[model samples]
Target: MTDGPTHYPPPGAPLPEEPEPPRAMTGGTRPPGPPAGGPPPPPTPWAPYAPQGGGGPAPQPGYLLGAAHKPGAFPLRPLTLGMIYDGAFRLIRFNPKATVGAAVLVTAVAMAIPIVITAVLTFTVGLAIDASGDVESEISTADAAGLVAAYGSLLLSIVLAQIGVIFVTGMVAHVARAAAVGRRMSLGEAWAATHGKRWRLLGLTLLINTVFLVLFVVYVVLWVLVVVVSPGPWPIVAWGLITVPAMICLSAWLWTRLYYLPVPPLMLEDVGVFGALGRSWTLTSRQFWRTFGIGLLTVIIGSIAGSMLSSPASFIGQIAAFALPEYAALLLVLTQAFALVVQNAFYAPFLAAVSSVQYLDLRMRKEAFDVELLREAGIVS
Candidate 1:
């Protein structure tokens, strides 16, 4: 060994130590003291708090936030009943041409078809009754058959009206969904979106209506039994007092639970009728009272609005009827038609918008659908 350079430590000189690694300054560039202001440090966007009871991690700072801060047709959060109501009106206000025009077109067709069928059936039945001589005389077999045919035609017209309602509802729902996310959809666009789905929507409506019809028939049968087959008055009175009310309550409850549940999935998810129903049932689970209360409130509000709009037409009709008694029947028909058109135009969109908002609200609470909606709107990456 060559003892290179013969280097040695000087006497009393401390051995050089490795330089200490730099410390991470808690507050960069500031003295080791509290921040200058009394206000707390801003929260770290990445920092997460533990949930209470150690259930789960708390939501991240921006995770639950909605798409944009700007107010749209719907707020970027879970909706209140009031918000839903307001949103419904806002949708109508935002897109009257789509909402009102679609409703009017569909409702006019629905009303016209039924009215024409009913009129023709009535005229035919009246002629037959007249041919049978005295109108108030006992019913003959032909007259009975004619009456049955007329009533059956009327029933069919009613069914067609229901189908038309389903079509209009689907159309309006599409428009409402577009409006909710700050989009404007034309009536044609809405109809096109719902074009292939109307039959399925109609099927769903028929299914629901059938359920209601069955309940009504069962109620009527029970009532008949209570009146005709019961031994005494107390039973009839008891049945009327208890069973009827119970059935009515049950029907109302079921209606509230189901009425708006399927619209969202049907329109947005593009699901089949039965699939939509199942999805709706799943979404509505454990939230029956909330959904029911919102639905009932929406119905009452829409009904009041429709009544108010239609009342003016009715009042004017009454005035005309009194002023021109000879043309009273004609005025009555025209005015009633006008009222129906007005009611349908105004209330159809309103009900559809309410249902759309309710559906969106339900999905947000259950599925965090706001995130999805925001993402789709490109508000969130």
Candidate 2:
């Protein structure tokens, strides 16, 4: 072929162009087509090779490099116990003005109204009782009637206070729910959410209290029967040995199963009293132990915190009493009230947050609430 295109070109001549190789063998290997033995392997779609160790795809960077993902107010995944507690505190921290401020305002108003009413009634009744000036041994019918009226007024005040508690709890539940969905609420907005639901919450509270009261009465009757009607010391001892522990266990169980659980669905879902109760019962059915454990832990923590705060407040109150001996009683009452308000400021939101988080967690376990929340937030398709 013309001396095979000259093994070497003349020293000054431009290098001759090399002939093109076959297209199939261009890269020093034949282009892939059919397997050697079998019909062409089913056409395999091109795909990137997996990383060597078979791990998941690399994680995406967050808003800041190396930062953990923050989907919303909380992580967009099922929560752990620690996460629940953390979320509770975070809810308060995220909107302390709404959560803590509202609690303080509501509690102050609630407590103040009842205190004023009771004080007025007590003052009026005391004046009447002193004016009568009845002998101690022979009490007049008017004095007895006045005493009954005073006691009735006290009972009414207590009921009103309980209703106020229900209202405050409903308001806090609304705030907690809003916080869960990454929304900040104002006190007015929370109040609006709770406005129509107050009566229902109060009814639920009354119903639960009535049930507990009935149970307590029955227990007391049983104890009386065991102690008085039974023939011997052995029966009383046996009753004490068995019923005391049993009642303690029962009370603990009831507290864990029912307390604060219905409030979330009641306020969030706009469910009625009985419906909320049913919802709570259903949600807690299979998760009793977990719920109980979490409730116990939260109560312990709250108790410890309350003790820590209240102790200092009590000490300060004692010091105030000593400093202002002439107004010792007044100072003691004012300081105690101040301390109570402060304690409620922290505890109320904390308890509400715990209840709201627990409600979300239960829904997540049973109904994949995290997915629903993500979908609602437009984080997932």
Candidate 3:
């Protein structure tokens, strides 16, 4: 948390003048000088609103903390923790509550497919393993193998289920955003934006996760080696201490960017995954520290909340597994399925939405989003 200076211009000061035109060819072609004062090119339209520092907006307290921005540069505006909390509220404001609810519902339904698949597989495999007949006999090894296969199938089914959830969530977010802003959008309107580009998005996501996963595995392996080869328990203790926090921080950082990877260009420029990623990187690069800091904060907050819910369920689950293996197995399978469903239900829309909002903010910074917003609001007229 390095601090930076924060500065703002006096509100009443007229924005600085435009640079003077090149000295009119010094006596050569002075013929075309502006029609003897015909309204001076309408004041460049954007000039009057520019901040004295040349950025579009004045910084507030805690914005940049101790940093000064030059005129005509992008400034990091104050982003309070309250703004994020309010973003959830904004979802309802921008669209009817029903829209967000519908998105969540669709996500839940999409998630259920995998759970159902898992439950059916578990039940069938479990029953088959416990059966004894001339036609169908099961050895312990055979039963174990079948169970493993069933689990594999369940994992595969979940991947497909998640993809479906992704599409539905993106569509829902699109419609919600448009509707929130009083724009008309159909189900097709949402689908139309990303329909043909699904594979590309998937591939891009795979690439990113792959990179992170590989790095993670390498980190884990190195830590394990250190522990095994260590002379004492100090190495193990130190590794655990560092790895736990690092993993937590890593997960949070990833989640924040996950929501925005393709959002800016997808919503604004209408580009596909790769283009959107490139564009997002460009916009985010300028404000890396702010982006990373805010993202880490969100993750930490969410992790705390998630841990509260998951920890108790985990202990209860462990007790059930030991007390009643067969019934507990079924319950465990069911619980896993349900968890998947819930995750898909909420994650897709939430990610899509935050990305959309961040896209709006990015455009405001880079392209003067406020100007467009004012125009749309009829404030500029």
**Residue-wise C-alpha lDDT for candidate 1, range 77-100, written one tens digit per residue:** 788887888888888887777888
Error of 2 at 124 (Å): 15
**Total clashing residue pairs per candidate?**
0, 0, 11
lDDT of each: 0.69, 0.66, 0.53
Winning candidate number (TM-score): 2
* 10 residues in a row with least lDDT, candidate 2: 60-69
Error of 3 at 150 (Å): 3.5
Return the candidate ranking by TM-score, descending: 2, 1, 3
State the lDDT of candidate 2 residue by residue for 1-381, as single tens digits. Answer: 264532333223444455543343244644567757877644433334557788734432332321121344556566789888888888788778667787666556544543454345334433122223321213356445544554454445445544555666677677666665567777778788887777788788888888889989999998887777888899899889998999989987787677659998898885798899888888898899888888888888877886787678778867765664433333444455556567777776777778778888898888787677756655456
Instruction: Give candidate 1 misplaced runs (Cα > 4 Å).
Output: 1-71, 109-163
Total clashes, candidate 1?
Answer: 0
Name model 3 segments beyond 4 Å from true: 1-81, 92-142, 172-180, 184-189, 214-260, 306-325, 377-381
Candidates in descending lDDT order: 1, 2, 3
Ten residues in sequence with the least summed lDDT for candidate 1? 128-137
As a whole number from 0 to 100, the lDDT of residue 215 in candidate 3 is: 73
Better of 2 and 3 by TM-score: 2
Model 2: pairs clashing at backbone N, Cα or C within 3 Å: none
